[model samples]
Target: MEHQIDLTVEQDPSRSYRLLPEAPACGPRELTVTLRSSARDVVEIAMWSETGLLPQPRAASHHARLTIGADQIASLSARLISRWQRFVQFEPVSGSNRLREKKPYLHNANLTVRPQSELLAQVSELAREGAYLLGELLAGEERALVRFRGHLLNVLESEDLRIRFDSDLGVPWPMLAVGCERLLEGGRLTVDPFRLFLGHRHQVESTSGTYPDYWWVSDRHHAVGSANLDKDLKNVPLADDVLKLLNSRLKDLNVRHFSDKLLPDLAQPVLDEDVMYFFCHGSYEEHGGRTWHALRLSDELPIDAPLVDGYRKPHTDAAARRNSVALFHPLVVLNTCFAGAPATTGFTGLSAAFVRHGALGVLAPQIAMPQVFGAEFALRFLTCYLDEGLTAGHALLETVRWFATTYRNPLALTYGLVCGLDSRVVTSPQEGTTGS
Candidate 1:
């Protein structure tokens, strides 16, 4: 009853995997919705479920074209995105930009407009509306969507559902709402839809497919790891806590990568790391005519998408020959602002750069997070993932639930998965045969 996947990949030589213990197969009802740009203006929605559902008792999948396009759907989210800036800043944030969040503790003496509360409702409402529109979009198609809605309704209160979108539309699927109210006309949800925010209530991840590659733990001994933390923030208490967490999980934390004392070493093609974590500033820059994201590991220069790709060029020959990715697939956690948002043309950003180079997946904030909350979120997420042994998707699910219900913070709702929805840390290979 192990849920671990066996994806074999050949290295220049070899690498370590993980040990799998027996576990149960029963889990939350899950669905993967993939949206792709078909004609620049037009888009397609492909829905499928691996678990049973109503309208149909069997698992199912269906593909159909949407009359509405990505451009339109993406446009609806702009208000939420733009208005969101008032709530928090990047680098988690800096003193110059108000690093502390303003949303959680707002001046609501009159209760007229609470940014956090209102934003949550706005996002949740949009999510629900999107679901209803889907039913309308597939008006004449097979019951694929019909069954899809049925499954969504089934998980409304359970709040333990798993929904993943393999998309390029840039519509934040995690923020999209789903409910029975609109679909049923007068059926008000027993629970508030804002509480049903997909990112808050369920385990949701947005993914972008990569070039063909199989899974392989990047570490030679499953003990080596790196943390590309910014030098300036290294002394913060939470930053210390993070280093301690990594120290415990990894066999040998690469001290040089801590602040990359050399900084330029970041561009060196890496093949030995099991996990690459970044706790630094994330910013957007205009390059040529396109918007690209960059990461600051030191005061010298920024590490942008192209520079990230440069690291992998050295291994191009090997990857091409093996029909596999050149870089060893390490799990990447980007606790930086907008690290989760990908360009609609396809994923193009700091996070995507790592994903493109073969990181197991990237976990990042879709928007700028408050520094304090950002640190707390990283602590909890990494704990659930590294210590508790949950897949990245489920870990984020539990993490959001904890923050929303217990801590009452909504920023965690913005974390997105750029791939590896089902990726978990590989402890070692299963008992017997060589992981060949």
Candidate 2:
């Protein structure tokens, strides 16, 4: 005999649950009803089991008090996710008992419901199951924090465990992944509402600046460049679509497109308090009485040639020797190689040069590879940092982790780049001045 179940909330008139053809009352079985509230209001959940059209309340006054932490509840809730492997403590609760006290269970038998994938899939299952069988779920008297595993995302205020239907770019999944990984690996499980609330504010607006605080010293032609493989390497060693995705992200970051022509006005005062991004062939040069970490515009022209003459050398030893500084130490994103590698003399290449000239931090790749993955990694990593409120290091780790998971390859080797520059580099430095 099929039974019907109905759930009513006393406090929330707006919210009611309907579960039809509920399971027949086969003795007393523990029912789990998942409730996620957008606000701190006490949510009352009622579950009733019926048989033969008779209204037999399997559990009456079956209530669970949900006291949402100030940080968890948001003005506008966004869905949160967690991975199965990260299963933590869940306090089992029922209408029969108030304060269902038990030692925290780090593992859940139901975690095997889905194979471990990204954090998004795991939480969605939990939330859906809760909503699917709302009728038979018994709410306990005391509020219980059912700790599960997942990441979180929201508009600009709060994170909720809800459905994610993406017609386009609404949620930043990579950012959320980074945040969750940081919490788990660092052994920090709590969320802070105030900081999260403020961080959400930046997402609502366009991140592009009216006048970019940074500049890219790149080829003049493909100034706003595209990734093109050389003829010798033409078998499409890797997917080109990945490169396209990377470029799309770069465009969002306001990275100007350019070809291999040098822009003459690089040495001019373009440094802002923001950052500088260099995406071109970069390495150290030990020739022409000029030994420095060089950033070569992909298509180099003669310095004295009339065709392109305005690009000034960014640094002159005389200026540093004289203790004279012209621009602010901008954060340098070096999408180039040997930038952070230490030389025999214990001197690094590009990072050393940037630091010497008063740049905050330099983000660069350690090894050389095909430009496709490199560009993708750089763009995604930067997007994570600037848009997702992640520190430089966290962003790098997350980007690599995503690659490792998605491609199931040793992305950590190719794109598992490091953020060589430290955050503290920019702190002591004053605004518009090189802190040396």
Candidate 3:
């Protein structure tokens, strides 16, 4: 169903507000307030006097003030914009936040939040009642400070103090301070962990930015025992017992489907009936102080060219095409560690890049972990995918089940390694071809 949320604010003249204009529509998730007089001096106002996550505006008027040296207002405004942008970035499922200022004493703001959960009930709710929870679940103050271009035209709220310090010359102190407080004290809204995960995945699907089968590129290498390797070099490492269980679930199955040249690189080329599987390695590289994901290729050339060519057989490149390595695509499965590390690199890892090119999906780890768990998880997951005719997500769910049952661990930590595509997406080159 369609998901839409609209919130408005107005100045309450009945009660004098320290903040220039009073906005009643300011709720837990978003706020829009107009300041009557521009805040030049440090003005105090209640931050959540109108509303917040607890279902009530803060009873105690929390102070928000701005007082700083020259150009502090501009800095504060920039900080506010930055914080709002960050909030919107995480709430990717929602449309871009539309922030409009109403001059002297008013500002309008809208935002959304989708927290990842590891519970099942939440998943069902998200699938059926996503819009319903928009109001209840997205209730938290995304705190940030806004120093105007000019000094305090006038104070808004009295109880909530808005303070400004010339010493706060660096980043906006109020914004960072509040954000830190929330991170340390205010945890995410309580929800079914499974449903939380489901909701997060659903929202991810709804985002405009592309998500690769594996957004993060892992640098960790996969070591295939001699017994597991097919002549084509594709590694199928499922043990006999696992294979039996898998075969029993999937009919009309053939092991050769994975062995044939499914993976092609720029050094290799593609051909008819070709199948491609990419196992990319990535890591955060720190040079001089800045760090980025380290990419490995058969050659030094940029990955975009081969990706542009796709599966069509190329004459000049055989090794690259036959081996089938794509820098970006849905078909590639990146099983690297922190392949999609956060903060520094964000989502530009191997997995994300591959998806942007042409990959239907990806499978990559999100955090650092032992090699054994990752390998076992990957093997079990692949076996399920090929043998049970399961979709990537379902297969992952099953894998998690297996882990929970086999290890008997009440808690298992693994980043959500999602396959970003519809289940109908074809892995085989010929699957998309018209009638024979």
Best by TM-score: 1
Model 1 pairs whose backbones collide: 17-428, 18-427, 18-428, 18-429, 19-428, 90-93, 127-176, 127-177, 128-177
Q: Who wins the lDDT comparison? A: 1
Predictions in order: lDDT: 0.61, 0.33, 0.32
Cα lDDT of model 1 by residue, 1-436, tens digit: 8798999876644445432343224354367677788676677666657665323434345555666666666665544454445444312234587655444433211112334445445434544654554434344444654554454456544567677777765666565555535433354334544465667777776666564355553233234577877777676447778778888887767754433453444455446666677888877777566676776766657776777667665565466676655545667888877777644232266666777666767888777655666777888888887777688888888887787666555567778877666666644333123554
Model 1 has an lDDT value of 0.61
What is the per-residue lDDT of model 2 for residues 74-111, given as tens digits with 9 covering 90 to 100? 21122221221122233445587654644122322122
Instruction: Indicate the worst ten consecutive residues by lDDT in candidate 2.
Output: 203-212
Which tens-of-lDDT digit does each residue in 1-436 have in candidate 3? 9979886765532111111122222112122222211334433333231233222333442334433322433344343323323322222222455433222011111011112242222322322222222111112243423322111112211112212121211121211111111121255544322222221222111112433222222121211111111222233343344334434433222332221223343223322111123333345566576545543333232232133334432432342445433332223444444543333322244544444444545555444333334445656766656545455555655665565445422111233333342332233333332321
Looking at model 1, residue 342 earns an lDDT score of 48
State residue 275's C-alpha deviation in candidate 1, in Å: 1.8
Report how far residue 28 has shifted in candidate 2, in Å.
53
Task: Give model 1's clash tally.
Answer: 9
